[model samples]
Target: MRILALDAATEGCSAALIGPDLALSRFEVAPRRHADLLLPMAEELLAEAGWSLHDLDALAFGRGPGAFTGLRIAAGLIQGLALGADLSVVGISDLAALAAGARRSAGVNRCLVVNDARMQEVYWAAYDFDDRDEPRCLGEEQVAPPAAVVAPAGEWYPAGNGWMAYPEALATVHAAANGPVAAIHPHALDIARLAASRVARGDAGSAADAIPVYVRDQVARKSA
Candidate 1:
């Protein structure tokens, strides 16, 4: 099945398509530029693949716990595309996508992701790759101060910028890692892969379900 996915939940923004010919992707670390870049990236991928939004079997986006604006941008775009095309959509977790990248790039089984959430807070989650190579979140995703982040005991690989964003606060958390990889962000490619799985399993949602997931809901709640 053809799947198109986009991510703008961090400084990094990416768009990816996985289907027929070959996988195509565009990514850049352009903070505050997601609004400008993400759409063009998606259009380019679809154009290069000679497909339109309607040709896609499913649409996917990083439903997030990262930049509030970035999350909204992606969700709004996904909703428009899905609704216009009358297609189903999937909301993949940025934290889960980060963990999937860790497994794909480094073969790490366990992952702990803590992305900067601003205001001295972070979006954190733990995951383990099962034998099927699918990432399963160890617990619910959360947003909290770095020192308040709790991870299950294991040599989980440290992923995301929170490790660098609040080094002193996260030192103990970092010390429990199997090894440190450079700070990383979620990618649309991984999001597509995860979305494909969900779509195949009949778990894809309607266009109206394309909504941003702000783990720390008070701010979003107030705005809503």
Candidate 2:
């Protein structure tokens, strides 16, 4: 299966292509240039694989609980690409993608992902990796002040810059198990891999179903 994935939901922007035996990717920390960098990056990755958009079986992207503009940028790109290629679309959660990064980097089975929500709050979620290598959401995604969000019961490492933003609150949560937070952001490679699994299970949606999962629209709108 040939799959293409893109993520522009934070300071990091990335595009990746996953073919039968080849995985090619490009990532950049261009906070204000996701709109500019994403497509060109996609073009480059496709060219590297000697494939075109129409050759892809599916398109995937990081859907929010992230920066408003960044989320829209990713969704818009996926929509256009999916429509043009007449492919199925999957919206991977940005927080889940972060958890996937942590799982890959730390070899952990459980993770707590928190992305800075930019209003003295965070977008948070708990994930447990099932045997099938898919992340299962343990709690509903939410936007909350760090102080009010309690850690899930069990051994789970924290990830994302949200903990860095509110060290005191995160420190309390981590004190239970004291696992180190991963220093990596979500990558398009993980997004593509996860989306491939989902697409295989008949879990894709139509292009019109492409939507951002903003935890707090009010905060997102204010930021926009």
Candidate 3:
């Protein structure tokens, strides 16, 4: 099946198209510019592949625990696209995308994904490459202070911005770790790949069901 994935859940904006025999993508690290970059990037990728929205089997996006505005932008765009094209949609976790990105780019089998969740907390989850070479979630994805994150089982490679943002709190995790990935963002390519796996397992859902995974409930402090 062919899938088009979009990710603007963090500082980066990316779009990818993956199929049985083709893969194409466009990515950029653009803060506050995801609204402008996402659709055009998807269009360009589709044009390059000589395929249109109607040709894709599903649309996937980084349903996030990253920037709230970025997550909304991606989800809104994907909702419109899926509705217009009458396509199925899959919401891939931003954390999972980071894990998948690490495995694809760094060849890491075990991944510890931690994204800065603002308000002095982080969104984190653990993953291990399965027999099928897919990142399998090893534990519950949660939002907590960096120090509250427990180290996952086995030697793990860390990825995402939280480690860089809260080094002291995450210091202990680094000890039993393999190392850090140079650059780790939830790329659309990995979102597409994970969505494909979901599709293969008959897990794709309606466009209206494509909701963002904002792990935190109270996103902001109560007004004084």
Candidate 4:
């Protein structure tokens, strides 16, 4: 199966292509240039893979609990690509993607995913990987002040910028737990892998169903 995935739910923007034997990707940390970089990055990945948008069987993207603008940028691109290609779409949670990234990088089974939500808050979620290497959300996704966010009891590796943003919360959680933190970003590669699993399970949805999952919409405002 050929799948294309993109993520712009934070300071970083990335696009990736997953083919039968190989995966190609493009990533950049362009905080204010997501709109400008995402498509071009997608184009580059597709070009490198020698495939067009229509060649993809499905489209996947970071749905959110992230930057409002970044979430919209990714959602809009996924909608356009899926609609134009007549392909199924899957919206992967940004927090889940972060957890998957940590799992992929650190080879850990459990993770605490958090992204800086601005406004002195964060987008947080806890996940544990199943035997098939898919992240299962352990709790509800939320946007809240770091102090109020509680980690699931037990041993788990912490990940994402939220830990860095709220070191105290991370410390409090890890001090009582068994494992340490593993800092990582949600990469497009992880999104593609998760999307592939969704597609295989017949979980892809229509383009109209491709919606951003913004936990805190009001936090995303145009600055004067």
Candidate number achieving the greatest TM-score relative to the actual structure: 3
**Which residue pairs come into collision in candidate 3?**
none
lDDT of 2 by residue, 1-224 (tens): 78999998889999999989999999998889999999999999988889988899899999877888998999998998888888899999988898888888888788888888887898888888898877889978989888776777877788887887888876777676447887457889889999999988999997888898887957534435
For model 1, residues 131-203, the per-residue Cα lDDT tens digits are 6688899988999899998867867788898888899999886877888863499999999999998999999
Select the stronger candidate by lDDT from 2 and 4: 2
Candidate closer to the true structure by lDDT (higher is better), 1 or 4: 1
Q: Write the per-residue lDDT of candidate 4 for residues 1-224, one digit (tens) a residue.
A: 89899999989889989989979999888888999999998998888888888888999999987888888989999899888889999999988998888887777778878789988888888899888889999978988888776777667788888877888765766565446566557889999999999899999999998899888857556767
lDDT at position 188, candidate 2 = 91
TM-score of each candidate structure, all chains considered together: 0.94, 0.94, 0.96, 0.93
Which residues of candidate 1, in runs, are more than 4 Å off? 220-224
Query: Any runs in candidate 2 off by more than 4 Å, and if so which?
Result: 220-224
Please write out the lDDT profile of model 3 over residues 100-177, one tens digit for every residue. Answer: 899888888788888898888999999888888887888789999998887788788999988888989889876778
The whole-model lDDT of each prediction reads 0.90, 0.86, 0.90, 0.85
True lDDT of residue 5, candidate 1: 93
RMSD of 3: 1.3
- The pairs that clash in candidate 1 are none
For model 3, the superposed segments whose C-alpha errors exceed 4 Å read none
> Model 4 TM-score?
0.93
